[model samples]
Target: MQTSPPDPDDLALFRDFVAGTRPLEQDKIAPVVKRSKQKRPAATSNSSTAEKLFFFSDEFEVFAETQGTLSYVQNGDDPHLAGRLRRGELEPQVVLDLHGMTAQQAKTELAGLLNYCEQQQLNCACVVHGKGLGILARKVPNWLIQHPNVRAFHTAPRSWGKHGALLLLLKINQSTEQQFRELTRR
Candidate 1:
């Protein structure tokens, strides 16, 4: 909001307008601000909030929503690690293509692949969601974001499926969780 300074011609009128009001007593009062920790759900194309431009933050950069892409990394993640993936330095051993598959089929296949990878301790994998205005391409990113095993995702390079594909970094916590359960077993 923008406002002009009081005009000399209107100063008398302004003073008369506020003649009945006294000055505020604000000598000792200070305001405290509280920041909310809640995170809003990722906006989609149909969402009303989708047009709001979300700016990048200092801690582990995110430029997806405003840039109209799906790439994201958890806050406090090692920048070098994220940079390695972004720079296409990391190659994924496991790559799954969801072309020609329906949404349900793709989810099931992705789940199976992710579960196998986690059980086998596979850290990096690639998923090709296919191109050309498909629903799977739109939905896959959101699915990847919500998956517990997924740590980060980045757009694949030209040779890898370009924007249609994503490189996923997974958190292999199955073994660690098992060991913890055994240690606390009674």
Candidate 2:
């Protein structure tokens, strides 16, 4: 196919329309700067200090009646939180069973669960530490009291687990606080 040239009149009109425009002065693009990778500070020493501050001492004695319900509320938190937990008003989003684990294992699991709950922004969790011999039953409460994320806890309702389990209310992240507020409002 042979091409035809642009109409002379159309070309003249196009030049008139762009008569005042000037070519750009600097056409070369600026080079991108390569940033050096920053070295992250080591976490070993910092984590050890944090662990010491968040310590769960085996010698920490938790006083509770032999056959009574287990309950706790963090200082300055609403006392009614325990009542709500006991009544099953707040449902647990995660459940942990420490049936056959040793005390150290249970503590480790509990710490990991709390960390996971915070990471996932979950507000509630249940810990089923069987009533057998009451070893974990006693140690669990002591360990829970040391965790900063535990807002409140109460013995589970009969249908959930009764005296053998605990309904834990974890502190909600700021991003999810509104959802919990709306839930409580209803």
Candidate 3:
């Protein structure tokens, strides 16, 4: 069915009604272009070298308690470091939690953490091994002992996981020591 055209008077009235309105200055908007994230280079070589450098031996006799509190101080260093760590005098700059990771994965992560701490000139770090099956608890101290950067370590205080974690005192360079001293003075 064909419909009749609009009345001329009605069309004229509509045009007059819209005659006062102006057109939009810009109708279309520019499209946004999303940038792709850049991928970081793999540290395979660094990790491999760290694995070789931070080797832990199962046969080595670590005298620390296995399922209980642990403590160790490197030879020729101040013995008070361990006491300070246990007393929570030194704050940990980084904390690593190894709750669900396997032994190998924990080892790799521990190595990477220590390396990172050393590179950043961090003096203290906390490693939480958890009290699961006593596997990592028994091995973490031994692994820490093998790393030369570990100056001293003690079981974390009651506030910091108690027996399930250890506070490590890393061997910082002279410049780091001066910086720490300056910071502590304030």
Of the candidates shown, which would achieve the greatest TM-score relative to the real structure?
A: 3
Number of backbone collisions per candidate: 0, 0, 0
Model 3, 1-186: lDDT tens digits are 999999999999999999989877986889999876987777689768656545677666575567666889999998888998988988898999999999888888888888899899999999999999888898889989988889999999988899889999998899888888797567
Model 2 misplaced regions, further than 4 Å: 1-53, 64-66
TM agreement with the true structure for every prediction: 0.55, 0.70, 0.74
lDDT of each: 0.69, 0.86, 0.87
Model 2 misses residue 67 by how many Å? Answer: 2.1
Ranking of predictions according to lDDT = 3, 2, 1
Better of 1 and 3 by lDDT: 3
The worst-scoring run of ten residues by lDDT in candidate 1 lies at 49-58
RMSD of 2: 16.5
Can you write out model 2's per-residue Cα lDDT over 1-186, one digit (the tens) per residue? 999999999999999999999988997999999877997776546575456446577887774453689889999999999999999998999999999999987877787788889889999999999899998998888888877889999999987799999999998777698889888898
Clashing pairs in 1: none
lDDT of 1 by residue, 70-167 (tens): 56686666545556566777678699999999876776677767877877777778899887556667667766766666778888877787778888
